[model samples]
Target chain A: MTEKKVYNVAIVGATGAVGQKIMKILEEKEFPINKLKLLSSINSAGKELVFNGKTIIVEEAKPESFEGIDIALFSAGGSVSKQLAPEAVKRGAVVVDNTSAYRMAENVPLVVPEVNNEDIQKHNGIIANPNCSTIQMVAGLKPIKDAYGLSRIIVSTYQAVSGAGVNAVNELENQSQQFLNNEELEANILPVKGDKKHYPIAFNALPQIDVFQDNGYTFEEMKMINETKKIMHDPELSVIATCVRLPFFTSHAESVYIEVDKEGVTVEDVWKELRNAEGIILEDDPSTQSYPTPLSAANKEEVFVGRVRKDLDNDKGFHLWIVSDNLLKGAAWNTVQIAQSLIKNNWLQG
Target chain B: MTEKKVYNVAIVGATGAVGQKIMKILEEKEFPINKLKLLSSINSAGKELVFNGKTIIVEEAKPESFEGIDIALFSAGGSVSKQLAPEAVKRGAVVVDNTSAYRMAENVPLVVPEVNNEDIQKHNGIIANPNCSTIQMVAGLKPIKDAYGLSRIIVSTYQAVSGAGVNAVNELENQSQQFLNNEELEANILPVKGDKKHYPIAFNALPQIDVFQDNGYTFEEMKMINETKKIMHDPELSVIATCVRLPFFTSHAESVYIEVDKEGVTVEDVWKELRNAEGIILEDDPSTQSYPTPLSAANKEEVFVGRVRKDLDNDKGFHLWIVSDNLLKGAAWNTVQIAQSLIKNNWLQG
Candidate 1:
């Protein structure tokens, strides 16, 4: 193997929750980086974050911020990414965006390294990360698709409030306290912060995650629907999603029903494939009361799947329960994996 | 129509969560009650419960507690129901059990009132109540089963901890606080209190509810499997369940995948049936962001269902999301409905 050369790395939105996780993941992976740059909004420019025993000061993100930066990771917000991503690309930095800005764009490569690593080479300056729910579903289903072709997916998600950003997390805490104390709750940032009305998420479930689309599906649900087709590269594939926010802090759980193309596939057959697949940890053992849970999957990098079984009547239908830390595999780690793929494939320099 | 005569009613396990809700339902429905007796364990005896502007003192439940009682409602544990239910029946009372003691017994009719109200007339002195999860599933599916035959059912439940009793609710609150403050959490009553190991349910999901059975299904899952057959009166129907306890307090949400025996049935067909079905409120308007959530259904009596769709590839398959207050429709309201049926049908006479 050729000797590795260190490259300059830049993280846009370096002060947010997913941004913080990206910083920690970069340190944990010990990525070969000659220099690190942290960029955020002007209001948060003076904030300090320590990484690799060095205090890094955050700076305002602008086109000039990408000078000499080989890789740019963006997670601030969709609008921020829409404004700064192309600008960073114009400065010769490859962008791995963690927002919906370019995910469905015809030109952007929506990637999950383990599922579609080769798709990274086709990126035109920017690569899109799939939604957290979409990422875990595709990761678990990819192997199944490879073993037996997939035709349909019906998913109901039990999502964490952290996916709405840090403010919603605080709102869950505050509203939960108010509910416990029998005090009136003030709701500002649940369901969708920009939506017309707010619903309390403390000890409750909100069927709406993002804003509602014209089709009656929430933006979050549509993201899973569209992103699954894009990531799996099967527009003909049928998918329906109902995303609900629960009172959890970290991991997202999904009840997924899938129809495979092959016939006579048994639960044993699916379990065998999952046990041997990469980046997947199968914890399904009904005898030992073993299965994946949000708390157990939190802070873990692997996609945990359990409660797998074949449909009782349909020979080809199957059900799975998939869980993963939304911030890690869903956002930060997936972004870093794409960056690593870019470096390995020599796509970053272009 | 002949005049309806008021009958005596008794509530076992009074002062408990479900027992309190039963009292509320009875008061709201203004059920014909010439006398109301409240019975509880010795520890809760002498407690005063206010219903309809009258204070009823809780008496200690015993084998002789049902003497002179006409209609007896039991929400106590299975062991307590096993010991006292037959005694109540022997003393000229019609016992409606909300426990699992005689649910699958040969002679006892497991009733949902809406689904199998006529089956209540076949009860040999005692009528068994189905599991909370099973009750909601059967209620939603019974209508569909009547219009279109059901071949198989696969459900994954997002259950509330309050189903485990009051202590589990307290444990969830305490653990949530400990988790938020980064303090060490101690789980004492979740994932089956009698089991050797306990897992924290706050900010977590426990895959196992109740204890495990010989067939690798938890007792809760087995209850759903066996009870669905008993209530639907279709032993040939295949049912599988994965019961999970979430941090929520009262409502239970289930993702149900079913295969219909008839072909070419669209989602609208099932929706039409549910829209006119009694005891079911169809809250499924996706465009305006209207769907049944646990918070909205927490204190409600109806089983709320939405997100109904047909499987894209399978002509016989469909998916539905069912949500209901476990403490109400799943327990208390169902018990009260049975009581009303008893008096209306004149089955209360010994």
Candidate 2:
């Protein structure tokens, strides 16, 4: 096993919905792939897909499809990751970028491989990923902001419609079968499919997700208040969000609140730091109504947290709920766990 | 105009869903009734119900069905509004109630005729009504808490499924056609059809909206934090709800946030006091993706303020969204505007 170095990946919106959930989570995490590719655009190339059990096809990406490509990922849109994520980091590839194109870029490391896997060795080769409602709300409040010390968050989300992709999940299944057949439901795409208005997410909610900013928030609420202070490095904390769009089709829930910074934090001290955190899943109890819902955290991939309490009057506030699976742990298992933490910490050359 | 005195109302859950939207908003606000009883329960009593064009008949709610009811209303469940709203207020009928039995009953007032219609002249005979997600979030934050003295109110909601009534709106339309025919959904009722589990709001998002209280919150998040501080008379304000239950069927959006104790204020000064308050309908602009959603404030009847903005780092916070029709202005147009402010302030002999 010491000789197992596999690599080559590539996905780039290969028939999206988070690029077919990053090719079914890289064939259910049997990822040490030596060559998988896929790519997309030009009308979803030829479209074949499959993965672990063979058949690839998808093609058309170009910039010489990242020559040999050692791990690309990218969920396709912010102008196709601002034109092929630096041409797949100038051919040696190492992208990860699931859209808001290089998430607040300053050397691109918005990551959430469970709250900053050491910001993946400070990635300069593009490792962004963060916003599927800020990747399950900072991966369910990064272990209650690393054992009580957060200062303020305030979220609200409840998102879904497959994070507005796959044609807003076929326009929420054709406006929920035209609102259960009473008809008239059609609305071109969603709260933000290239904005200029389009509502009716079937039963409805739409507080407008992406597209609005010039101060009034909603570029998915300033990408969950600037990718949660750039992945919790906490730029003077206090965030804000609000991003709605409900009529679900895959998890996103949220409701957050936070305030911590100690001073007797409780809810059993944020459930003992979300039961010793790590891709969290607490599912609070409220005496067995248990918790976590967006269809029981649909297609689960962790980060469920639940109705944690404490804030009848802010003894440093609390309130949680966070959920997940916005296409698996919000966007193809946090972009294949930051491409499996850049191939098991060998941090793939920037 | 001086001959306008008709009364004799009644309607206790006139066949549910906020008593059929309080009989289609008392037949579209032609409320000067004279005898429109239609009560229910005892297996939806005869169920005729047509209203303005006549038919009527629901009947069964006894204790002499509030005899010559000068104005009743109740809304059936909460042990039939704590047994026919005190026998329709010992036969004189000022009631109003729409359940959660006498909301926090300190001699009951809870009303939200645009946030405390002078607490309906200190009602001693039940006026209650407040939680259909706390009457459109304290009637869209009572004109930004009378222009900016609010303090705090978090909220979250997104509720609907007819605020959990017509069998949780037929279990969200038979679990959304058994999740659009992939089958196997069947949840009996919802986030709380008398709690103890039953998720699947078809497409999902039920952060338990009621039942679960011994301090973990949810009795619809402590009825939107003890009825928005007893209809904003402010018991040191600072509210905090989180109720959820989405996969809608008719309005109840929320998202709220607020903070306000004066200071600089401006999101156009909370949109010019939500464009001069009363029954608010601001629908914030955000360059035209305008706001207010839950299916564009479903059946309408007011409160639909929009994404008001302002909290970029808490300039006294802000961030609204609201929306109405959780059965018209959250439960039959604020219980027929507190029965038209207890019959145009004659106070209905409370």
Candidate 3:
């Protein structure tokens, strides 16, 4: 048997929701790793995490933590990624950041592997993972855009609570339990954790996702609009988005309306392209009630697309429902995929 | 003191979700009624419902039951409306129908009092109340359309389970309790209860709001499309809808995208129109994190419009967040409003 080359891997924010998912996914994928290190804030120091039957002790992340690391996956808050990602890069480690810190930076590559993996080669020692909702969306729509060309896009997301990180998930669970028990529902960590106000997500939907921008669109909406154009390399695709946080705990689902550039693409044509696309599973049999729900798509790494129908009024418009596990496909798996793509294609350089 | 004139009133399907709301609204409005007649299907016959501290038995609906009813509100079902509305009209009752039976019938006026109260004058005995989702939407959009001519509309609804009926509400409660208990959920009523498949709606969303039409659009979607055009009196205006059944038990919320004929309309312009529009409550301050969720809009008589913003890409297009108690403003209150309009305007020729 030919020996496979391995490299040293480290995970920043080792105790977070997405960070933990990254650890499990890396193990499940059995990525070629010679050594594994876990790093977090000093508050999490001495805490241990398991990877491939070995207990790895977490140390405080700093400039020295990435000295010999080949690749570091980051899922800490934006501030942590902003402070440490450059440090990691300076010490010869390529970073796949899962925060909004570097996504829109001119030199950084905001990549969804299925949509814009080639952009990874243009990175300056760091590749930014797109937002959880944006990741599955670009992946689902890229095949259609490639097959039939594209004109405009409008998306409304039914996002999961886990996208807001660990405390938000706990808030949802706690609020749900309170709601069922007829107790007072608390709202301390939702809509936007640092915003001026908080709202309960138990049995309710909030239209604001992230903080409101001066122009009235939420930051999450702007991230979707900007990142999609960047990943697709279309500066003028006329993209619009409404991001709403639902009560779901796992997967993020989107209702997408797309107007193809080509005039005569039918629903079957889109279906054919989706079925042949990688990292996509077409679940669209209306007769059999085969479509993706958050529960059905939970813990899965593939983007599930369904409800493919041509617009009743417009010949060029099509509607679709796309769903995926926000933690797996949206954050952790995509982060690991970027690392895998870099290693396999020999595109990593620091 | 001069005596006020009182008319005999009847409520068809008096035990139904919408009908119960109508009964309560009539009492709250202090409608001038000499006698109240409650009618329902034989399945619910002999059920005594209290209104204004008086018990009224729900009799099986018969054609002769409308003998002296000056204004009859019908919400039983489409077939029941088709059979009984005309008979009520023959017996000198002006029917404000809450079903889809006579909605598209020629000479039958579809009225959302805030949108087109004048349409009630053209009614030949039966004035059709628009669909629940459609009523709230048109009521919310009418002011904007009146101030700036509307060219196109596309709406996606986050509709509640109660819009399906009372049994769907029970299913949601039962399924939610079952979900909380870690037991398997049973879904017998949702997303068109008579359909072959029964998917749980406890913590999930079902995209199929009604049975699928041959054109791939659900009937509920078609209703919103057709009813919007009809109530707005603009057959040439393009309208499209995607209705999804959510887990909430009360209000139906909509994300509406509109393209206007007039250009340069700002978010402030839309807000000004909504603030002054009748039957619409503007709840749109991002600073305060104010917007209508289903829970916030439940049991309210007015439609709530918020999150108003101009589309970033389309200059003439705008987005709106509209919510309302589907049973109140969407059905019962609208029905009572139509009856009030008839009485005030002397439009009930029958």
Going through the candidates in order, their DockQ values are 0.50, 0.35, 0.64
Question: Residue by residue across B211-244, what tens digits does model 1's lDDT show?
Answer: 9775556799889998998888888998978787
The best candidate by lDDT is: 3
TM-score of chain A of each: 0.98, 0.36, 0.98
List TM-score per model, in order. 0.92, 0.39, 0.98
lDDT of 1 by residue, A1-350 (tens): 89879989999999999999999999999988999999999999989999899999999999899998889999999999999999989988899999999999998999998888888889899999999999999999999999999998888788999999999999999988887778887889988898777888888777778887655557897899899999999999988787888888899999887899999887888988898988889988866668888988999999999988776556887878899999999999999999988988888753
> How displaced is residue B209 in candidate 2, in Å?
15
Error at A84, model 1, angstroms: 2.5
The C-alpha lDDT values of all candidates are 0.88, 0.82, 0.90
lDDT of 3 at A174: 84
User: Residue-wise lDDT of candidate 3 within B1-350, one digit each (tens)?
Assistant: 99987889999999988888899989999999899999999999999999899999899999999998999999999999999999999999999999999888878999999989988998889999999999999999899999999988878788888888889888887887887778999978876889888888877878888788777778898999898889999998888887777777788988888999898999999999999988889999988889998889988899998888899988999988899998899899999999999998888883
Span of 10 residues, lowest total lDDT, candidate 1 chain B: B341-350
lDDT of 1: 0.88
Model 1 residue pairs with clashes: none
lDDT by residue for model 2 (B85-183), tens: 887788878887877877887988887877778878888778888778888788878877786688888888878877777788888888888888888
Residues A90-160, candidate 2: write the lDDT tens digits.
88888888878678978888888788888778887888888788888888888877776888888888888
